[model samples]
Target: MTNHKVDTPSKIEWTELYNQLLDKVDVGIHVIDEHGKTILYNQKMMEIESMESDDVLDKDLLEVFKFHNNQHSTLVQSLQTGKTTKSKKQTYFNNKGQEITTVNDTFPLLQGDRIVGAVEIAKDVTQLEKVIKENVLRKQNTKFTFNRIIGQSEMFKSVIEEAKRATRTSSSVMIIGETGTGKELFAQSIHNGSSRSTKPFLTQNCAAIPDSLMEGLLFGTKKGAFTGAVDRPGLFEQADGGTLLLDEINSLDPALQTKLLRVIQEKSIRRVGDTKDKQVDVRIIATINEDPLDAIAANRLRKDLYYRLSVVSLLIPPLRDRKEDLSLLANSFIDKYNAMFQMNVKGLSEDAMQMLYQHDWPGNVRELEHTIEGTMNLLIEEELITAQSLPTKFRRRYQNSQSSIPEIDYPSLSQDEEIKPLRDKMTEVERMYIQQTLEANDHNISQTAKILGISRQSLQYRLKKYHL
Candidate 1:
């Protein structure tokens, strides 16, 4: 057996290592003595509070940071109660007079049951809360209705019929579709058709929200619960008797998924830091852009929550799957853009329609809508849209698809054919070659010239000579 000798680190070295580790962490850390004097404040805490160690070290916590009262401090609360506080939101102004909000987990340090100090771990959510308020919390009185949804395909019609049936009942709905497939459109239409059409309609995209903010954002917050918390109604409360659309619900944290399931079962919500539950008559309409079974198998979504929210599950087919409606949808977009762009464009040409029908529409309806909007922006005097007026990238896709066909369509030779001049024959061949190269490369002058081993000026001269 081999014995390994280990050199123990000195007390000073150990202390330095601990300080370095604390400074390197992303979360803000602060420790104060039982008497409420700052003892340890890490680099992140300084960044969060916008102060230096010199400004906070050994200073009284009350003097260093402005609080409504001593009870507002999580560190002080933990110190006084001799207990740990987890995920408590605290808001206060620093000496810089900036209102800082943080979600803190504070623990009291004990030396054999004798209170020494309390250490706090905080995550800054001041800016996040502001963004949520400005963007996510605002109510949108949706104007979309079933009449506005346009699609004549049997599959699409059946899906719309199913959605219409859903509106008749108040059961929770789960809309599943690819991104930009008008999941939100269907959601809004369903809400407008429902009995709660006069009520508020709210939405929140759950994919990017941090876990700490999700709870309070969904459920209301109680005043005095945190340093700066006020009595605020959450999405459920704000959308009472209406619909609260939680888009991308599968992206939510599993713990929150459990909470959501509870809310669905109980039909009530308890505000953050509140002891009492409030009954809310809000209807939830959740949407996910993935296969629910796949999400559940990957553990991204909880099966139990899926079962609860999917009482009226809807699978909206992607645009590619319903290509039969391409012409109808294109004409609708043409009409819409005509009014918006003040253009009198009548319709799409046959060639342009063929190109549109060839597209797989990976972005679904939104992509098609934008394509029409974009194509119309380039139209000037043309009354009808031609393939030439389509976006360059779109035209390139159509051209590339045609690349597999024979490059030249030779004119049929007659038995008594009249011979043309050699120069004319060469010019005809050169024009056809240049035209093919131009179409293949999205008609980009520089790219076509480069592919043909000619300068841009040379290509421009040839294009004019051939009237290409």
Candidate 2:
């Protein structure tokens, strides 16, 4: 009879298991009793608040936790009404007194029909909020759109329309342009207009990193894989579920280019020194100053990689090629610098605009930006940036409407006046100049030599032989 009744734990065991699972979870968790007294707090919650379980338990919620004013009222209301409320709240402050933002979920805990307590779960959202704020600021600060591309030419308009249409698809895109032609801005606009607008759009400059480090940086590395590696994920991993922009993709070394090709084809990457592969769902957008096809031909880039990257290729014209855009771009930069440096400079004069148009802008848009900034710094009272304020090189190169030399006029020689032989005419002129110099110096050979930029002995010999 005693051996017949060894029973297993029932619903109580399941409830206890659930509580254990919540306690071991990574998110902060807490429970408050009907009297608004905190009854239980998991380890994560205690660590986040930097307090002990005993210090928080049996204390009133408002007194136990440091919640912002608005969050405190909302949480109290949710508990009193036995309703569930989810919102972002600032609840904890670090030791340095910096507030930590958290996404919190508060739900009423019921004992049958009566509400016994409330459970709150919070996730740290500080980084996410910071990113959102930064994106908002970037959008507000820049006039980056299809219309703001600074070109009215038909070719430029066609390119913008093509880029906008490409953004609708999830296919890979390659943007080719020279330096300072706003390739990065074009990439940003495409990502912003894409269907994945809400997701992250990250960029990596391929030319900025060394070859050996680039592999690890793009694909990430495991802890202790290298000198300072601490199990970090790379840009490709970070950009998973969104778009990854590879700026200066042509600068990537051949080895890394091959790996990138694999990533693009396979949609998976194994971190350096890691055996397991990670699946990444991302849209790839690559930009380069040089032609990827040329790079492939030169063996600097993998052919397969180039083909994979250029599934849809878009070319951004250099500013010089888009002469019509010069005025628009210049005014945009002037407006920006005017607001930035707090200057009263109005705009460029007609002559100045003409000078800018005529000059071959070797540095493209970036050069124009610097030139405008320099003019603003030097300009004090002049509201308009005139041709006079432009740098000497810019003015000199573009000044002449036609040939810079003036027209010449000559008088006809008389037939009666025997035109001296060409050589005899030059000899007479030379003799007269030497005699005049010697007389001016009182016949001092050294002084005359110095004046004529010749040796004293040579001057004395010439004077004696010529009988001057």
Candidate 3:
């Protein structure tokens, strides 16, 4: 026993493992020394900032990225003050003039009682900004009315009635449901049913938006507020005398929620970079994809703001919870699409309807609608949708649930089919595993990556390679 030798990893080996672990995380990780020089930059951070290790390693933060001032940089501010900056949204330009926005949480690394360096965790929202901008530009007036809402279930009808009652008053309304459960549809119907239906109806999704930009987007912006800034009306102003739908209100920054609470209390708004408070009579109808209590417990939503916005809260049941309406909804969607495509397609076959009922419908009604639409695309001479005609994604799920054997782990090869090379067979197996894992996680890239035991970057590469 005394002569037995134990093998342990060396310091260098441990360091290499630590670095690899950092690169696997979905968010960007950056570390800087007290002198503001980059010490450790992970792979995700490099991808997010569009720079390589050669451009950032051992370089000053100011030299690598363009910030208005030292104070504007979260890592720098944390280093100088030895204070933490949590979930602060920052927008800055890289050396290539490409604007990057990230939600950052920075902490000062300390040695005993002295600050030594700082580490930052950032989540990029640059693409989200572009999507929000495009959506805003393409926004049209509300077209959904209560009459257009299709649901015959008693529970569904009760919620519809509650929403109808909400339209009679100007009080704030909160619609709660899971994603794709038709929260926005209910929101639009409420706006159209209200007395202020003739007025402008505006919608803004608060999720994944930077706070700085969100502030100006919600409140008006004053002239010369920032570079190229002009006087512009925000959602509150645009939706004046009408309803403003704030989708996923919990996603809004806590500070912005405080401002919103004040607005609801005073019925007024103060533009960004302006001192004057202007009155607005916009009715607020907010939506949340989770339980409000959970959002408050997690500190994602402010409690006081929830009370102000939920004067008339309506909860929409998930599709699985109210399966009585499944056939009604499916037939409606089929008729709508058939009219749009100018095709006469009959209703779903018994097996097809059984497949629909077998699913828990994690995506709810919207998922069912999309399933029908996708199945329709595969139809040519077939007038009715059979179980065999469903999209591969849905069909595979049904098959896997019914099969005793795990078809997922081993791809089926027909005896008469041509044999493929080992490389091609392995590639096909890898692609299938990635696709199934992605579907299991509801197409969430980060979660899918984690489930697949790979980095988000690697998962994205596979998605592009397989066109999944």
Provide the TM-score for each candidate, comma-separated: 0.64, 0.56, 0.60
313-388: candidate 3 lDDT, tens digit per residue? 8888788766878898999999988998887888998878877887888788989989888888878878898889
Model 1 lDDT vs. the true structure?
A: 0.85
Candidate 2 off by > 4 Å: 1-143, 400-468
How much is the lDDT of residue 87 in candidate 1?
Answer: 73
10 residues in a row with least lDDT, candidate 2:
134-143
lDDT by residue (tens digit), candidate 2, 210-295 = 57667877788775554234466776787777788888887889878888989988999989989999999889999878656557
Candidate 1 C-alpha lDDT tens digits along 1-468: 999999999999999999999999878989999799999999989998889999999988878888875447888888888988777778899998998888788999999989999999887778667755654434554879999998987568877989999999899999988898899889999999999998888888897677877888889788766644567778788888889999999899899899888998999999988999999998899999977877898999999999888999777877876788899898999999999888999999988888888888889899999999988998899999998999998787795775576678777879898788976776778889999999999999878988986545446546755788
The all-Cα superposition gives candidate 2 an RMSD in Å to the true structure of 20.4
* Clash pairs (backbone) in predicted model 1: none
Arranged by lDDT with the best first, the candidates are: 1, 3, 2
How much is the lDDT of residue 101 in candidate 1? 85
Error of 2 at 333 (Å): 1.1
Ranked candidates (TM-score, high to low): 1, 3, 2
**Can you give the lDDT of residue 152 in candidate 2?**
78
Residue-level lDDT for 34 in candidate 3 = 79
- The local distance difference test score of model 2 is 0.75
Give the better candidate number (1 or 3) by lDDT.
1
